[model samples]
Target chain A: MRKFTILAGLLLAVSLAQAQEYAPPKGDAHNGAALFQKFGCYSCHGSWGQGTGRDGPRLNPPPAFPVVLQQLRTPRREMPPYVASIIPDQGVADIYAYLSSLPKAPDPKSIKELQ
Target chain B: MSKRIKRRQFLAGVAAAGPAISLISTTGTAAAQTAPASSIPPVPNDERSLNDMPPQTQGKSGSDFMIDVIKTLDIDYCASLPGSTFRGLQESMINYGGNRKPEFITTLHEDSAAAMCHGYAKVAHKPMACMVHGTVGLQHASMAIYNAFADRVPMIVLTGNIGNSVTRQMNVEWNHSAQDQAITVRDFTKWDDQPQSLQAFADSMVRAYDLATTVPMAPVLITADGDLQEDTIPPGMEKKLYIPKLKMRGHPTGDPALVQDAAKMLVAAENPVIYVNRYARTDNGPALLVELAELLQAPVVDSHGRMNIANRHPLNHSPRREPTFANADVILALEPVDIWGLTNYVADLIGRPDLPPRRNPNLKIIHIGSEMLLTKSNFQDSQRYAQVDLSIAGDAESTMPSLIEAVKSQITAAHKSRFAARGQKLHEMSAKFLDAARQDVAYQWEARPISTGRMVMELWDQIRNEDWMMPTESQFISDWPFRLWDMNKPWHTMGGSGAQGIGYNTPAALGAALANKQHGRVTVAMVGDGDFNMAPGVLWTATHHQIPILYLVHNNRAYHQEVMMIVRMADRRMRSNSPNLYVGTKIEGPNIDYAKIAQGYGMYAEGPISDPKDLAAAIRRGVERVKRGEPALIDIVSEGR
Candidate 1:
């Protein structure tokens, strides 16, 4: 969900980055959803809060609201650049809310899940 | 009368009775969920609905449903060495992606995985995705990616990352990922992304594909985090995901003012020389470049990999960088890779095309390309190389056509050389070289083990006339058959020696062909079989796509170049006999049955062709299968035995 949010963020980046100050869309996941598809984000990222662990960055793993948003608003190199309206502030807030609703971080025992 | 017999045979075949198309495996995953709690594999009887995947509401995170998308995109298989970075996602890819879904091509070396992806892509036309193990995996695959990038192949890489240790608490997240991983491939990639959210992950997929497949195509990579790849989204988001239609930025044209100025300089020069690289990589680059040469009766050097113009054109000269410099009064470097090398050589010879490629006190040099000009000086203390006189870095493809129009507007048609004399000179010179080369023992450029020459000749004898997606190992092709194979059209053949990476033949070539298959051509890769075995897994990708291509395995049992080097070193060191000499470099014992391996992957296969006499016929047979719309392999076994 968060990966989709970031990807959706790229297609609409010009608008999202420029409209950082705009009002939130009514009842939208705002930051609860992060457009993940636009960046080829989830191709490597996980379907849920978990990142695929190689190329995809960690989405808000839990306490999801705004966590994924926080990471996207700031990123490392070689990312096709993104900003707020390209992803909207309200959309970010809604997606953040949506993500916060997902499962919490995996327990340390998750690696045990691999074998 | 024969028709009646054939019909009877056909009827008999039909009466033999075949089963209905069946699901290959309906429950690699679901059997664990439903199926009455049994260990048995799910039967094809149910005919699983791909639409039924992602059972819950897959609202924003489209990850769970991407398997269907991969199917829609026609990705038959992916050749990747598995890693924990993509563990969860890989689970979904296998368990859920379905029968025709891109299957995981297990591999040993990460580079082989990438190269396999490269090979598959050339023919698959769509990206046959390669997955890497975080930073280390990326680093290993970098060479193959570079080759894919340089060759302009469309590849999409899915890298599983363990997000920064401090950033996420996901289990084992610290063991993977590079801080700024995509930076490693920046020089050649079209686009890259590392989404921090599920929704964005899915959306960028469309964007990455669009960019990778755009004109002037190249691979694009996206880093997905292990944490992000498995996250579940809200309900039904799979249906909501949309791949945005992308509009490519077209090639830019020069201002009439700029074109006129450049053209004036070109026509007026006494000893003008043209330098071309990637332009010749494009179908138009060669034509436009040749037109300019014909108009000026000037010499052209092939920094451009393939010989666009006749090499023996009185104006056509060797592209070895130095002499190309001495003879030119004006220089135009089109799509140059080493701008520094070109400029330093032509500093006093040529000037700008958009501006001029020449440097120094006299010659005018123009640098025209879609990307910006980077002189070697960019690396060395930031000093501009003799500095380009005129530089236009947008759409050389379009710019040249217009310049042609402008030059035509001014220069008399009679000014164009009939080029008859020059053509003869080239033919004569080429024959002379081939004659001398056949005898030359210095470097043994003609030594056996499928002398790059023999390989090309065999390839030409086989597939020159049929439409082919030619993904050549950069060096081998340029040395020979470059004169031998005539590529007069865009996408006629795709190759990138620019980066000089091996293992690319398998994946990138296949990927590009996959993208262009509807364009209708047998995608052919003339690669050393050693390289073939390097990423043999890609064959499955090709098989799955049914992309017709002939993979000619130049099976020289040894890495011939290494043996040559070892011999050189031994002779130099005068170590009369080193048992270790050329020991590890060979693939001996019983030579590999590459034909069997190819057949195992579902392809028509032939060879271990030791005799050169068998080369043509075997090649013909292989070419026939490719024409029939199936991948085929010819293991042209050659070595100095």
Candidate 2:
């Protein structure tokens, strides 16, 4: 799922307007995967990054690394803000790499349940 | 008598008396020191009385008379878990009362029993009685009682306790008995009584039903003593027992002067809105509210406490609550539980429970409900105070007739034209929201790991045509059904758990299904996996009673809501390396097989169906089974949120 996912299209239109001018630094996917669970990002976003429709949007095929970093640094809505002192720049880059590396949601038409 | 002169005879007599006195003192000390004030056993006047003729047993048990009183109240069902304290009454209900009017429903847990009553009341519009084992049962049932109280649903809670210490068994009975069992639910119950005699039980039972069903309805407790239940009616005492005339008082009306004033304000306002929660008590509730809203052409925002109005109605503004409140000049709040929340901007951020008023500076708020008529100092379910320009202390449904008339009288030819113009704009806004919602579902129209929206829409496709009632928690299903489905009936969606308890959805939904069974309404419930695990046994009761329902499990496989909160905490703490958040929160290591669990409870079951394509068929089969008058379940694995 992308930034223009289903529920986010409905609920978080306001939060999606954050500027994404700055790009994040490159980081390792393995460390990112480990940090994703470590930081408890899986709580609102699924363990595999399928965002809770009402709570958080799907992060798979995450937004530009800069947008992800920006959202963490300064959340627009109910999401708690994460400052650099907390989730340092390195941590944010790794988490973004992990999210970006995840597989896209399978096509519903191809899956038996969605048919 | 002359043998007392001998030393041997004197010694024998002294030895026997010594132990007897010692035994008496030991019993006295234990009773005085350890027993509760009411449970203290009286010291024996003479040991000979213990061996005397068995105490005269009553020819007619007092429980028989108690059953007669219960019969008078016309309760249709009585849910209970077995306990020895109420054994006599339980027996009388079966053998004497024939258990037909208020049939005994054996439940596994007291909470489930209470929840069932809660759900049953929402649909039946009358309370179903429930009996639980004394103090422990009430403790188990406290959460459900709180939920019922918060929802303002009427329920009659009959608890059993040993009234006579002399009749109590040594250990278990002592543990089970309370001097005043009503204290257990004193904070939440509208009223309660520990009836000492059959007559008192009769009077209290009638009073409890009256109070529970009155405006600002709530659960009421009546603790029946074991001795009173077991003891035979004192000879001719049956003639003395009087069954009080069970009368449910007409709902009180709003004051005429205040009604006129509120009507005038509403009529004059440029932009007015009606916010309602728990406004409906019967089939009449939604219609009455709609009539008033239509007359004024005002937007009505249902909080989904009860189905106050059809969501698809042009006047319904639920989807646009924030904007509606923002623009309102006059806001009429009816029976809303969270008046403060409706009127203010309460943020979800840390330590800020309240923010500045959400409405306009000069917004005129007129609140009407029996909220002011019933309240308790303990257990603050009532939200923070919200200032109101006018407050009417009466039942919203009852007061609506008079208020509607007043509004009708105030509307002139000029006002009629204004109302039409306003209605058209509101209708357009509603249409826009509906269109947006329709498009929103199309985004993941066929997404794998079925979207909650897709899943609910799929279920809706099957049941939309049936006379359906969905008794579910709002959070579990999200906003999909409300946004998409035609909730045109009062029972279309019976609303959320009153106290926001987790275990409520499964059992309460089942209870609603039981009520729907008689009416031939197809019942469906969307329950969370975490909630189902709380009281899976409800499925057994459904199966045993042949109460058909299609139970759909939103198997996110976690306490997803809590999971969200925990993650936020981890982010704030900068514990970027903490993997233990999942340890306590997620239900993953050995993911539960919900389908198998439902089968174990003897319901037709299928699932752990992850593929969205599989949902429609599974749901169809489940619906078929329910239509065949059997319970069924479908577990659909999906996104965590």
Candidate 3:
């Protein structure tokens, strides 16, 4: 029983480690715009980080830069991973900064079509 | 001396020289040896030529008689783009046939003709005729034919072929003639035949129709010979022509013992899931499926190949397919295209597929469908083979009643109480998903470059009250309606383009609209821009026929799916700066004016509307225009999906 308890504790520790959050480095918005276009992130997320339905999710009001970096490292769904070897850590950071700095989409209610 | 040689002199010279002299001659010998002393070839007398011709009467043309047989089949329309090979039949259809029962509906392209027939068959639940111009036309129509075949929809394709080489005219006729035109599409169609004579044509036509309409149905081809269609009936030969009666074979039902066995399994299992695709043929199908599911209190996962069940049903588990399947001890698949894919979890990641996840190892799978009834050796649309405990080769809809009865018989009072409790739990889960979907729409509801979720909600608000039919599945706004809209009615959804061809949406929607027009159902479609560009001329046909469809262009300004794929490829190679990827994929820079094109086709047009707020108003106006029995189009500048 004591051994089983220790094993359970170890298992809990492994899961906690896996769930730990990533820390992102400081990035430049201007550099991020160039990286976003250069890395073809704009192809799916759109030129303005407004996601297309068939391609990717929206990122204008960017998620935590760390999460973005993690997504690029180990992607979900159909998105391909961009490892650090392929796209340097700085490139991903720059993309996140650009997305974070991008102008927010205007209210759909303000648009003549949405009402 | 006379320029024309006398027939008597020429004949005398030929007789004296013998036929060998003319045959042995190379250049001038044939003509010179056959010529008289005047140095001119003899012309045959009109009376002599008349004697050589077959004895004939002014009886009806063979094409007219062919139309008579087509009429007996109760075909409503014969869509075609005119070709010379079928000129005789076309003339007969318009004139002698009086064009009433099977009216000749002129389509702009052969693909449009086939696609129109496909959509019509889906709504009407009956196959219609499509005529094409010999080999060239059949080639054009092949893609749509494959689409119909994949979807299990019936269509009878009639293409003109010149069977006799001797009878064919020079140049154009030679180009049009084929030993067998149906060969191009035979692998895709249920059956194909090239009839040699008028009697054969009638028999083949009827047989093709019967084969196409049967369960596990697909498009069938009958290449009508130009000779058979154009030739005048010889004296007394008209009386000999016989038209055979068409026979529609019954749909196969599962063996009673097997159905009972399946029922027992379902009854014994702790959790059972039902998956459906291409299962609903008409309103009765969905009703029967609903009844069966409610009886068993099963969770239904609709693939939306057709509207197999109401999306808003309390037991719908479409959004939770993976979880529901994972939990299921017994899974019953109804006409699913890829049972193997459904049972296995495949990661899209590079090497992650090495260790694919599967459902419970001991899970029992019972597959009921007519997928085994008819199959082609090629095209691979049959999908991968799946291991099943029991496979029933029968039509899902036809087998549902027996299965329902069997399940009902096995249920006890205690079992009923248990099932009711289980059903109540499932109902709550379904409500939760629906609420979640509604909330998801509110996300970015007011974002510019409008969100697909928001777009769908706005459109739904306008058309929810009307009897609306959307006969398309747009990639730009996929599954929005399935999650948010009420689709209980038979004509509410008409499924996707089967072959995944680009040009199917615009014409197919028009075709469904044409069918709905007679029934007074308001037909609408959200078509992708890339698909619309493939055959925008279909708009002309809609205007000309006055097909009152409200067409909305989800113009993302690119072949966005291809762009995504290209980007993924680029990312894998670590080469992000590629102009070629964008060069072919992007449809922007000078954005296509779809509304203007619609206006050119004489349709009520609006937009390139990027603003989200204007969507509802534009859709409302378009719906109003549709209500007034006029075709309309609105172009929405949408973001890529």
In terms of lDDT, the best-performing candidate is: 2
Could you give candidate 3's per-residue lDDT for residues B122-177 as a string of tens digits?
Answer: 99889888999998999999999999998889998988887789989989999988
- Model 1 fnat? 0.00
Q: B1-641 in candidate 1: lDDT tens per residue?
A: 23122323432332343211113123333343353545988657467667556554232223444443344344566767677777766766765554345767666667867765665554444567777877778888888877666656567787877675665545555646667678777666778988776556656776787777655567788888766666654445433444333344554555668778778777666556677766653445566777777766666677434435554344556533455576567788776655666653322111322323334348788777644422121123222344678876555667887777776676654445433344455445445443332221112122333344445566675676677657665353334444435555556554453455555666556665555567677777777655676678767767866877788877767664555445434433444134565576677887898888888888889977766556778888888887888889888765321
The 10 consecutive residues of candidate 2 chain B with the worst lDDT sum are B2-11
Evaluated against the true structure, the overall lDDT of model 2 is: 0.80
Compute DockQ for each candidate against the true complex: 0.01, 0.25, 0.27
Using DockQ as the yardstick, the better of models 1 and 2 is 2
Q: Score candidate 1 by lDDT.
A: 0.58
Tens digits of per-residue lDDT for model 2 on B103-131? 99878889999999999999888899888
Comparison by TM-score, 1 against 2, better one: 2
Task: For each of the candidates, give the backbone clash count.
Answer: 202, 10, 19
lDDT of 2 by residue, A1-115 (tens): 4555776776545444533444557888899887776666765665566555566676866887766776888776677777787678898888888877776655444433222
Per-model CA lDDT versus the true structure: 0.58, 0.80, 0.80
Docking class of 2: acceptable
Model 2 misplaced regions, further than 4 Å: A1-54, A57-68, A85-115, B1-58, B445-448
Tens digit of per-residue lDDT, candidate 1, span A1-115: 5598788778566545545644434434433433432222322233343332223344544333333455556643322323564555665565555544544543322212111
